[model samples]
Target: MSNKNPSTTRIVELAKQKSFNTEKKVLDTIKSMIKNKKVINYNTVAKESTVSKSFLYKNTSIRKKIDMIRNEQADLKNVTNHKGNTSDKSKDVIIESLKFKIERLEKEKQELKDALAAKYNDFYNNL
Candidate 1:
């Protein structure tokens, strides 16, 4: 007969059940995250899934999955960064357009001022 106490066996069984449930929960959480196209990283997964970072890092399978997904995302991130740089070019274009507008407005103001002065001179001469 096994020498283990009954209570000890019961406690061990409970611990095993809890561990299995936790593993399942973490796996399901990851699958759903992938489905939803959410960002997957150690910090994000830990925070979103309400699990400890150590737990995710410690589990061999989960660790591998996280590493693979993170690696794939790094490539996508580079592409996004490249697109975002166009904002700087757009800013330059906007600035040039505004400068052109200001120059045109200033010319119009000067013409109006000259016309006003000519009208005043004519009025005084006629008086």
Candidate 2:
């Protein structure tokens, strides 16, 4: 009941092939980005791979993989932050100790100068 010509059939076939190729290319790009430890968020991947954000969200497998990577990165960041806090605390303690030492040294230096001045005055008077 339809006049489907050979050229139209061939065009449809080529279009389908092109779409398949594009999808495959996008998936391949995503895998490569993951392997390279690149940021695997939806926006980043979509931008880098030239894939539509809607396609990424609609594909359940890709969406899940991206989510997994995102979660792993978040966990790593949290651990690093916790360790940094401990290091900061130690650094604070070291800074405080250095400040106390500087204050003690300044006080000692003032006392020595006063003693030296008194000794010089005594020598001048005895002369």
Output the number of the TM-score-best candidate: 1
lDDT, candidates in the order shown: 0.88, 0.84
lDDT of 2 by residue, 3-119 (tens): 575357788999889767867777788789978888778899889889889988887877888889889988887887644346777988988999999999999999999999999
* Cα error of candidate 2 at position 50, Å: 0.6
TM-score quality measure for candidate 1: 0.58
**lDDT tens digits, residues 4-101, model 1?**
75557788999989877887888888889989989899898888778899989988988999999988888888877644456877989878999999
Highest-lDDT candidate? 1
Residue pairs clashing, model 2: none
Model 1 regions lying over 4 Å from their true place:
1-6, 84-127
